[model samples]
Target: MSRMIFVNLPVENLDRSKRFYEAIGARNEPKFTNEAAAMMVLSDTISLMLLTKPFYATFTSKRIADAHSSSQVLLCLSCESPAEVDQLVEAASANGGKADPGPKQDIGGMMYGRSFEDPDGHHWEPMWMDPQMAEAGAHPVESATAVSN
Candidate 1:
C-alpha cells in the first residue's frame, strides 16, 4: 500500500476551520470526523485532521503553540502551474485566510510560489515548478540567489 500523510492541526473553532478548508478544496472525510475533530482530505495521499484545542492537548503533553503568534512548520503543496498557485492563494484569502504571509518567490522563471495562513495561522505555501527545469536538476537556491543579486 502507498504511504499517506496525515497532518494534525489544532483549531480554535472546528466549524470555521472546516469551512475554510472546504473553501480551499479539501473535502471532509466523514468516516473520521466527529464533534472534536474533522478529517479534511486534501488529496488521495494528503489529509488534515483538525482537532479542538482540548482534544489536541490529549495527544501531546507539550503546550500548544499559538499558531497566530508563532510558527512550528511551513506546509507546501505543489501545483500544476503558476496560475494554479496564485489561484489557491487567492482562494485562501477570500475564505478567511491571510494571504502572502511570506514573500512571493520566483526563481529564475523555473519556480513560482506564494504563501498564506489559515484562520489559525498555520502557514501554507502553494508552488509550481517547470517540469523541464526539474528534470534538468536545476537548483532552486542557486537560481533564487542569482535572481536576487
Candidate 2:
C-alpha cells in the first residue's frame, strides 16, 4: 500500500472553510464529508481533512489553539514551478486570506515559497523546487526548514 498523508485542521465554520478551499481549486470529497467536516482533495496521495471545532475536538483532549492569535502549524504544499507557487498564494488572497510580507526565496536552486494564513489564521506555505537546480547543487535538498546533522 502506498503511504499517504491526511493533514487535518480545525475550522470555526465547516461550510465557510469549504468555500474558501474550493475557491482555490481544491476539490471537495463529499463521500466522507458532512456538516461537521469536509475533505479537501489536494492530490491522490494527499488530502486535507477540514473539521469543525467540535468535530476536531473529538480527536484530542487538548484545548484547540486560537489560530487567529497564535500559530500551531504551517501547512506546506509544493508546486511544479515558482510561478505556480505565486499564483496559488495570490489565489488565496483573492479568496480572503492574508499573505506573509515576503516568501522564501532560494533563486540559485530555483526554489521559492510563500505563506498565507487562512481565514482562521492557519498558516500555509506554498512552495516549488526545481529539479535541475537541485541536481546542480549535488544534493536534493539544502534549504530545508530544519537542519539535521
Candidate 3:
C-alpha cells in the first residue's frame, strides 16, 4: 500500500477551519468528519485532520502550541505553475485568510513560492518549480531574476 500523510492540527473552531480549507481547494471528507474533527483532503495521498483543541489535547499530554502566536510547522503544497500558487493565495485571502507577512520567494528562477495564514493562524505555502531550470543547474539568483521578469 502507498504511504499517506495525515497532518493533524488543533483548530480553535472546527467548522470555521473546515470552511477555510474547503474555500482554498481542499475537499471535505464527510466520512472521516464529526463534530469534534474534520478531514480535509488536500490530495489523495495527503490530508489535514482538523481537530478541535479539546479533542486534540486528548491525543497528547503536552499543551497545544497556539499557532497564532508561535508556529510549530509550515505546511507547504506544490502547484503545477506559478499561476496556481497565486490562485491559491487569492482564494485563501478571499476566505478569511491573509498573505504571509514575509516576502515571496523565487529560487534560482527554478521555483516560486507564496504563503498565507489561515484563520487559526496555520501557515501554508503554495509553490511551483520549473523543471528546465533545475535540469540546467542554473545559478539561483540569475535564474530567479530571469523568472521574475
lDDT of 3 by residue, 1-95 (tens): 88999999999988899999999999999999999999999999999999999999999999899888998888889899999999999999999
Best by lDDT: 1
Q: Please name the candidate that would achieve the greatest TM-score relative to the true structure.
A: 1
Q: Following a full C-alpha superposition, what root-mean-square deviation does model 3 have from the true structure? A: 2.9
The whole-model lDDT of each prediction reads 0.92, 0.80, 0.87
Q: What's each prediction's TM-score?
A: 0.93, 0.85, 0.88
* TM-score sort, best first: 1, 3, 2
Q: What is the lDDT of residue 9 in candidate 1?
A: 99
Model 1 lDDT, full chain set: 0.92
Q: Which candidate would rank higher by lDDT, 1 or 3?
A: 1
Candidate 2, lDDT over the whole model: 0.80
- Residues 1-149, candidate 1, lDDT per residue (tens digit)? 98999999999999999999999999999999999999999999999999999999999999999988998999999999999999999999999999998988878778888999999999999999899887877565564542321
Question: Stretches of candidate 1 above 4 Å error?
Answer: 138-141, 144-149
